[model samples]
Target: MTASTHWLATAAAQSVLERGGNAFDAAVAGGFVLHIVEPHLNGPGGDMVALISPGGVDPSVLMGQGPAPAGASIDHFRAEGLQSVPGAGALAAAVPGAVDAWLMLLEDHGTWELTDVLEYALHYAETGHALGAQAAAVIGTMGQHFSEHWHSSAAQWMPNGQIPHEGDMIKNPPYAEVLRRLIAAGFDGGTRQRRIRLAREEWKSGFVAQSAVAFARTSHRHSSGSDHRGVLDMGDFANFSASYEEPQSINFRGTTIVKAGFWSQGPVLLQALAILDHFDDEHLDPSTAPGAHTILETLKLAMADRDAYYGDSASPRALRQLLEPEYAHGRAAEIEPTASREFRPGRIPGLKPFFPILTADPGESSVLGAGEPTVKISGETRGDTCHIDVVDRHGNMVSATPSGGWLQSSPTIPPLGFALGTRLQMTWLDPDSPSALRPGTRPRTTLSPTLLMKDGFATAALGTPGGDQQDQWQLLYLLRTIVGGYNPQQAIDAPMFHTSALAGSFWPREFHPAGVVMENRVSPDVLADLRDRGHEISIVDGWSLGRLSTVIRDPASGSMGAAANPRGNQGYAGGR
Candidate 1:
């Protein structure tokens, strides 16, 4: 029931549920607290994306994706001969939208008042909490990133001038003051404060707002004779009006799905499911040693097709055949027990070998699990990201991935108390590709939030935090539960799969069907069968790929069940 990651985060979610708040409330609360507690993972500076279904209505996705400021580009970086921008500078910044989105949701959909929702977060920020093992672990590893910037983020994190260790009373008195100011005065004096103060001040029209002048006097500190006072103008925040994204629904593999993306991985997930419909899952269990091969082969086939045309819908290509049931059945039909990594289970020639990449050392662990490992960040940066799932009493679901982890490429706006996304970190430095490092292009993200509906009602709202592994985990967990018959926890806890789309490869490709890099513990005989089938197999640890977040609504009891990825020590879900 608590966010083991941090007591403050858990308390905030609990506060929401204790009142009349629903899944979205809990998530928003969690996100706010995440900024205070797991500051490195998420903050107001982050952007948020959520998949939500209220009662009988279809699901709606909310996008809080921040834009790459008025100007910024990989070309600019390359021109400067720099691979990446510093984490806390205008160069590394993205216009933040998570707070705006949360405020919008609170205004439009939430049942609770803004102050009610923020009370717990404000208290936590004001009254510090003891740091948890998880937070301490994240801070310890990310200190080097903190050291990069002499000012901004690098400074705030190392307060007391050093990274605090585990069990320390992590405190941020300045951030606490920021929240207090936000609650009382709002961003732009009494103007932005109207959202919260409107109810009380309706009788007093004589009150001309002077809070703006007050804020001006007390707001941001001038940056060392440097004009980089990154305080967002209240006008800028006031001008933000969330677009009414048309809700779209599609039936994929008999599952009624709804979302808010016309060009995101959400649609691609639908396409992947469509292709899966063509295959057989009747006896696809990994329990039977011999059967694991078919399971691995089937996944590989699905993944191959996923990579080829999973692009912006604007570009039409040959994909219908790939979705054809008979074709997928034929591809699955060709599976042999012993084959090379080249026998692609997909429609096209599978993903080419990763050009011999001098892999960065060996195994690198992320504080909150790794997202998009293969989707590398070439340059420089610092960041924070996290995921949360909530199921309310009415069986509604809210699944979200809110990230500030690293500002897509900007520094810490201290007064902002939020980190921008290093999201630009996702783009290819290449100036020519679709997701090429362009001036304003949003990266082709794999952070997809999904709400899987059955019988015209959302039965599951799920997603994962692994950048590229997101869709992969989302689809895998769904299959493992809906078809594979694993329980919610089992489905999430199960050893996940990921294709190593390496830089380059040849004689023995690593990104093939059945080409699995499994945890060393899976039965050797079972792995041997996968290996015999031409898979380029490697053995990793017990916990691996696709750390997922899921909420399952079982109609049988009208109750809910949930599970977080085992990779991270913290994740909690339950009905309000």
Candidate 2:
């Protein structure tokens, strides 16, 4: 069974499963197709993180997130006349890790050959695939910038100087050729594993690295309205590789919730769950005013700590203390019927918290279109990210969020047929900050995927692609499934809400004190009640907020099910 943000990608995963491949192989195949179909959301030159549970083994995180380049330092960015990293440009790129990471997973846990997986992606990239409406619209919005500033991007996306209309046949022969070359490089190997390893080396030390490094040396227009050369080099790409890590999880109710470590925002979900666990079941139902208020308030507190403490730093015992039951009870007790508008991070007994200067009014301080890529020309709307969740018949499961490196985020590398990701913009400039920009440090990324288990068996795999709202949306789905007794589809169909009370992870770091954006699916009376409780409310269209997808396995019956968000027309889920 497979659930993903794109129907084509989901079909690809289903096809892989029918071909006797495990969940890992199906996920890798689906992920590659996602890069082609969801170009506006993800691409080949991006990064991804996955949670994989092989049958009869402990689940682990496939850490595909790349770190800052060896030369990417705060001093260098400041010297470039920048207060923060640009949202879209070569200067904001980190080492591309998605390709290597996907290949690593296939070699280690998958049964298919490298060529078998590449075949699906190759067919779509070489032959023409129908252009997605959202992708086309995004390209149309950035048409002017591409034509004037990024000629390489113009040549690829806007052929003949015109953006392709939706449903038009869009082909990426150049990207196909790149994949073919990598496949060819692996043919002269001893074993399947060796061949995959050869492909990885070629990606790091061969033409891929050379082209990326050469392109970074040239000046390009950035979100700051200035041109700057990138800090990346061949050595940076060569030195980086994806590896497996133990997942951090906590037992909630009877189910265990697993997520990536502090490097990503995955842990924030766990922290929020800990706080909400103290509330009664009635107060946790998202459909009601009290339920929504309690969840939103808890999210704000967890997000405050996220901004203050979560990162890739070593020996941070503060995280352990924050997740303690005693601490969670104390934090939950602070919530009142009225909303709290202040940015309050919990202080651990022996640890001093680092708080950056907060923007009182984000509207006045934010630069227009300065952070992550947005779909609309105005840049007010958040851009979409890609997610894939698969559970095979063998009970193996995987959930991955593959994002960053959208074509609109940077000038397309002519040879590679894609752009470098601007994920480095997530890092802060302050030395004391946990997510401070430093050479060889992983950025505190917002791309988070989730896995749930029960009695040592994988129960569910779920995730979405809404920058800071990823885990927030997932939290609602989980509460509905675990507490409210809703099925996967029912849980996803329910109204979703998220708070902007804490600083955003993207550039220009926007925040709104006690602000909440909820779908109008909630009752008018509930909305009025929330407003009366001092929560600032902004009502959006009924299905405009979350894009969550999930695949679940019934431990007792051994039956599997999958469901995707109906909010956007693109997401799909199918299995038998």
Candidate 3:
């Protein structure tokens, strides 16, 4: 996908595939290089979740999300009353498992050497990659996040320790040095003993393509980009490792299926799907006028289950009923067919009720009038995307996503040029139900790399990184494109919207429409109607105009197609 927040990043990912590396190899290089080239979004310390479709087998998934440090404890926060961890505190950090996860996938599923897999990242770090409009914009706005975290993050990002203007060459030799060392430990073909003859090998056999490298290198020289040298070291590389596991899958109505592997939110998809499957599709056609009503019904049910009952296995919630079809059927029956229900508290059979009165207020007040609604440009969102989907000449398909290490609490130990992700932000310290922060537990995450199966075979591989928004985006696109008969481009290009019980709620799910911004593209009357209903609302430019990068491959053509939402600077869709 070219419109990737960083085209240079996409160019690098594509280069990996062209060099004969598979999607796994390409995704690894892309994540690394993006960290070097687009530090504002994400870096090495970030986590990743992948959904891959191996030949005849169901799609297997991977979770490299880091866990709380062995010593992190709830008692600590309770005594301190720390509701939220700061961006730089040790308490906010986790044992980064992203790198180890990548290595594990490679060792288990990748056929190429580590050197071949991470070639693009190696080059971009040793040299430098260029910046783009989208990448620049996201950093410009979030500069405060960097300043609050590490000096390395700021010194390299801030111009003379200040924010750089657009087009500035944000360089970081210190960060670059980190990438150089990593390459030296692996990439450079500085073999001590080379025979007079080069081994006769095609790119498919695992050779870094000269053409791809030069293309990416040339792209780096002319553009404006960041200098985030990765933080891996010789010792870290030697110590990094991985393993394999069977994946989990669940079938949904109308050719829908969701899969996850050991230690991920994948299983949640199955639970939600089973829950939705309980609904009668006869009245919920999404493309029709009734779709909106159905969507709200399904999302509310899914989110409620997600909020109160969902948690890491280490917690004390009973999920057996959540995944049971009978429970879903009973829950769906609770919805009043004629009217949208107000946000309220509900119990799962025997569970206690939680009345989450809607409680959020207006956000980002730089306003408009009854006549002229001023729209604020969406700054580059942090560590969002860069994914690759491949169905090899062998018909084995793979889909992988690499994320930016979050800035809030991600710390970089200078010499490594990389940062540790403060993934704790994904979890709530004071969760009223389950999925709350606990000692050594992974949070309920948004990165669910998915492989959609239809007609008993893989039809598409898709996923994105937009926190909780990731689910609605992926779900809507898949439902529209694959199920509703829309093409990939049309599916993503179509207007979109999400019902956030949190952002709009008075406190968290305060049913205030003013705090909830929908796109102006919607029918104005529909907007007015929702506002009249006490569903707080505001209007954002693209709340429903399109989607992030989502790629689909039709086995019939042996070709891949991608559609990127143009609202954001770097959304792209293309194939080799």
Clashes of 2: 0
- Residues 1-576, candidate 2, lDDT per residue (tens digit)? 899999999999999999898999999999999889988888878899999999824999999999999999999999999988888888988888888899999999999998998888899999979997878878887888888888899999998999999999999988898899999998989899999999999999999889988987799888878889998899999999999998889899899999998888998999999999999998999999999999999999999988988888734455778788898999999899999998889988876677877874544222233456532212245568899999988889999999988988888898999889989988988889988898999998888999999998899999998888899999999999999999999999988888888787876677788788888788999999999999988877788878899999987888989999986688999898
TM-score (C-alpha, index-matched) for candidate 1: 0.75
lDDT of 3 by residue, 1-576 (tens): 222435666677676667776665665666666677766555666666666666524666666666655445565545544444333333444545556676566655666665565666766666655666555665565466456434555655565766666555555455455444433444334341111001111110112222211221221100011111121222222332333445556666556565553244555556555655665654344444345445555566665555555556422334555666777677667655433445533456566533333344423321110000112113123335444454444445655555535332333444555545555544555646344566556655555667777665676666655545556556667667544677866766666666565321101122431233456576766666555545455566654333356555555665666555666556555456
CA lDDT for candidate 3: 0.50
List ranges where model 1 is wrong by over 4 Å.
1-11, 82-92, 185-241, 244-254, 257-262, 286-384, 407-410, 429-432, 502-515, 544-546, 555-557
Off by over 4 Å in 2: 314-316, 363-370, 374-380
Cα lDDT, model 1, residue 123:
71
lDDT of 1 at 100: 64
Q: List residue ranges in candidate 3 displaced over 4 A.
A: 1-5, 142-150, 183-248, 261-289, 314-320, 337-358, 361-388, 407-412, 430-433, 503-516, 528-534, 543-547, 555-559
State how far residue 526 of model 1 sits from its true place (Å): 2.1
Highest-scoring model, TM-score: 2
lDDT of each: 0.52, 0.87, 0.50
Across 1-576, the per-residue lDDT of candidate 1 in tens digits comes to 223233455557756877767766776777777777666556665567777777735667677765554346665656645443322334433445566666666555667655667776777677776665655665565566456433455566567568777667766665566555545543333543355444222101111112221232232212111222222233333333333354445565577755545334455455455545555665355444444555555555544444333333223234435545566567656655654344242443432211122232333222222222222222111222467666667766676777654421234545544444445444445443334445444444555677778777778777766554566556666677767778878877776554443211111112322335555556778766666656666666666555566666765577666666655455554433
